[model samples]
Target: MDTQKLTIRLPESDVQFIKRFAEEHKTTVTEMIRRYLKQLQAQHIDEADAALQSITGLLPQNITEADTRRLYADYMMDKHR
Candidate 1:
């Protein structure tokens, strides 16, 4: 994978601990941080998908275009009130 250099500052003690942890775990500090960020990205995608599904499930199975427009118009009217 393509990678770029990123610089971050941490307390000396924290940095030392991370180095020890990485050595014991057979990985690097950069790898651990990358995995953590990937987890957050995955969770965000899952949450977004769930939100979309909930909205889609609210509508009828055979709703027509006219019905959709009417519903949207009603929602807009209520929102402005």
Candidate 2:
């Protein structure tokens, strides 16, 4: 995949820590940061999936199409008000 260059600024202490940790693992700081970000993204996906499961448990098991429409309309109206 194509990627663009990006620059960021962080504390000197944080940079030193990342550099040392990356050296220990034999990788660059950029790669370490990317891996950390991917792990966080996976964690967020897991949390969102759990929330969806909880919502499914709260909703009826056999909602008809009309019931779905009414529920959507009610939710929208309540949210707007």
lDDT of 1 by residue, 37-57 (tens): 999999999999999988986
**Which candidate wins on lDDT?**
1
The weakest ten consecutive residues by lDDT in model 2 span 52-61
Stretches > 4 Å off in candidate 2: 65-81
Instruction: Report the lDDT tens digits of candidate 2 across residue range 1-81.
Output: 676787989999998998998999899987877889999999999999999888876767898889999999999999999
TM-score of 1: 0.76
Off by over 4 Å in 1: 75-81
Worst 10 residues of 1 by lDDT: 52-61
